[model samples]
Target: MLSITNEGGSDMKRSFLPLFAAGLSLAVLLSGCGASSGNASQATASAAAYQEMPAATETAVDYSAGFYDAAAPAAENYDMDYGSDAAAGETAAPSGEGAAQQAADTQRKIIRHANMTLETKAFDEALREIESLVTGSGGYIESQSIDGQSLSYRGDYYERSASIMARIPAEKLDEVASQVGTLCNVVSRSESMDDISDTYFDAQARLETLNIQEERLLAILEKAESLEDVITLESALSDVRYEIESITASLRRMDSQVTYSYLNMDLREVLEYQKISDQPPAFSTRLSNAFAEGIDSIVVSLENTLLICASAGPVLVVWLVILGLLVCAILLIVRRVQRRAEQRRAARNASVQNARADQPPAVNIPPKEPEDKVK
Candidate 1:
């Protein structure tokens, strides 16, 4: 029985050893397969990421190309509108020259400015007429100012003035100015014109150039591969776009300004004082007028003097107080100095007298007087 048990135990141990070895081999194979699978997946992912970059670049390039193609005709149209000689010659029909001439005539961009000063007997009526003129000419007032003063001297005198800055249509600028001239007596008249056709065309050409540059930059941006390239191209594209917007705004402003003409109108009321008869006045009447004029001059002088005094009263009082205080201070100082000097002199004199009194007095020579009397 003992021998049988030992043999069975040995067989059991050998079977367990084989089973352990098989399990270990299977575990190793599974680990190897998993590592290989993970490596394959990683390689595929890296390849896909690289492939996406080219695909995105190609798409961006295609989009930019399409945009450029679309904008090409617009640029051509701009050139044609701006009167490119080549475009004009190519599209010239039977009346092409005439059409071009008309376009050239109509495309002249001019800025007109005018200034006029008018004097009128009636202020309100003239102002109304001028305003009506502006409105009738399809114009608007940019700014307006009215000043008036009524002085009651010997009689009531009215002085009124108005200034208006208006914008009128360029086509009707001359007509409007002429109409305004008829409203009142023109004191001064001025008109000026500036041609901006060359400048406008230059700006248009610059805009086209910038637009083309922008399109090119956009195309380059789409094809950019590295992060650094993308950032650089994007910055350039932003600058170009900003410039394009600025130029567009400037051109629009210029166009508006050129379309409207500026008019500066100045209106003044002329006041005529009551005059004596055209015949020579009587001597008595002349004398009375001279006397009245003298009285008026005296009254005006007195009023001006009163005004000056009123305006300067406080300042004068302040100055007077300051001067009084300074003079008092100087007087007090001088008095004190004089008193001190007098006291010092007195003290010196007293000291000398006391010294003299302290000294013995010399006896008078009475014998000499008697001798002279005997002689």
Candidate 2:
């Protein structure tokens, strides 16, 4: 009986131990799941708190309005002052003398633009040099349009001109401009700078905030239990992703503007460099100009007359032949009329003489009496 009781007690003890072990394991798993859920909830809450949308900007964005509009949610949603609360990934400006330098270095986002109108006697050489300069300076020609006559087209000269838009490293902008200036006569030149630091940082901060929101939304989506909850989370996730893409594109565009400087140049092919002077023309200049114009007009007239004669060869010959035939016909008609008049006068004279001869005796007596009276 003692042995049986001991066996029963040992069996019960073994069963109790197995059940306790199983319960402990289940409890640990349940606790882990609870902790994970709690941590996810806390993270989602934190992200939400960090990226609170402004009440003023709650209106729907009009994407067609373009990027310059007030619809930039990323720029508006970020709350911290840029000067005081340095953004998460960015290091704050150093405490002392280096502060100004550091601020200028990393905080400044300047876009430089230059415009120039140049005239060159040698267009091909100048164009080749400019292209070389752009390529050598690690730049690219954004756009180039040439609108003028080629040598073959014009027959006299290659008067081709080009409008070029090039992008190069900002530091090399001045150097390139200077080099180009040396290659041609600069009729006009202008330079400008734009500071977009505020805009840039705002977009960057907004992007960060949006990324946080996206990750949180993705996490919530994974654990979404109901179909409605899943749909809602997915919709939110898509919006977040879209916002991310838009902001990213804007930032990239800004980055390109900031990193590369814009060089707008108009290259004209010319035979002479235009005089660029602030002073009005002198009397001598005016007189010379007038004389030159007069000479040019005369020369142009002569050239035009020659060209007309050459071009109208067949027509001119036809007109000349018609004029000669007209003159000959007129002369021939005049000659025939004169001959008929002469013949009529002669016939009258001959008839008068015959009549005088028929009356000859009376004529002699009258002539003797008239002669005596005349003496």
Candidate 3:
């Protein structure tokens, strides 16, 4: 009976294994189908979003064409205006010509710049006048640079210079520049105008389009259901916002420059005021001028050298004293050396004389030989 029970139990286990295997396979197939459906839905959502963008962009671009036409009414209003003109029996400018003229005039953006080089006999007076002029003209000094005075060997008058960059109202630029020319000798003057009408209007139109795109993107983002869709919309929205900010900043900068023109002033201090001429001088005249310049340079250099020497008076004295002490020491050493040489020579001569005095045999031997010959 125990053996029969074991066989039945084994048979039951074998049957259960097949059933368990079939159930696992069915679960895998169902899970795979669910995953595939999810992926397909995600793809559909992404495709819908991406496909909608090109149309939106096209609509924005189309609207940008007439964005700056506020100066004139729409085409439908033109017929009404024409009928009113006909009933009133009054002549009106053609719609196309009038609108084009008005729009171009109102939309022109000009950036003006003027550069002037000025020389003045009085540096302080000129600089103060310029500052006062800039303020009185409803303008401000954007930048200024003035050379500093010398700390050592300070002089009553030195060669000084100044550079000023002024921002004046567009209408006041010419007036201010002319007034400044009257204050000092104008060495050079130049003016430039940049027309940024097309650039400005184009950017503005593009900005309007971007604004529309931003609104559309925001609307789409609100309805986004999937995480991938949300992420994609956020990234695109972020990009659009960045471009909008950049364009807005650029427009503001352009507006500021157009409203306020730039005037550059260079001022110099001089002893003599000289007139500037556009035509070159004669060869002989240039030679004389060069010679005078050379002489003036030499005089200036000598004056600077004198000033430097005067400023360092104490240091110069100390150096001279040191040099004199060195020369005296060298002379003393040479005198001592000569004295020692003379003393040595005198000692040698005395020793030779003493040896000669000690030698008496030569004379005695000569006398003895004579006596022996006589014997």
Best by lDDT: 2
C-alpha positional error of residue 181 in candidate 2 after TM-score superposition, expressed in Å:
1.3
Error of 3 at 218 (Å): 0.8
Off by over 4 Å in 2: 1-106, 151-158, 314-375
Rank the models by TM-score, top first. 3, 2, 1
Report clash pairs, candidate 2: none
Runs in model 3 lying further than 4 Å from the true structure = 1-105, 148-157, 276-325, 352-375
Q: Please provide, for model 3 over 1-375, each residue's C-alpha lDDT reduced to its tens digit, 9 standing for 90 to 100.
A: 011133355454334333322332333233323332211222223224434433443422222232223311212111213332243243322223344345445556789999999998878888889999999987899999988553223455567788899999888888999999999999889999999765654444444444544555565455444565567667766776887788677766776787789999989877788776879899999999999999999999999898889979989899999999999999999999999999999999999999999997665444346776788
Q: How far is candidate 2 from the true structure (C-alpha RMSD, Å)?
A: 19.8
What lDDT, from 0 to 1, does candidate 2 have?
Answer: 0.64
lDDT of 3: 0.63
lDDT against the true structure, each candidate: 0.61, 0.64, 0.63
**lDDT by residue for model 1 over 280-315, one digit each (tens)?**
989999899999999999998998898889989999
Which 10 residues in a row give candidate 2 its minimum summed lDDT?
Answer: 54-63
Lowest summed lDDT across 10 adjacent residues in model 1 is found at 87-96
Best by TM-score: 3
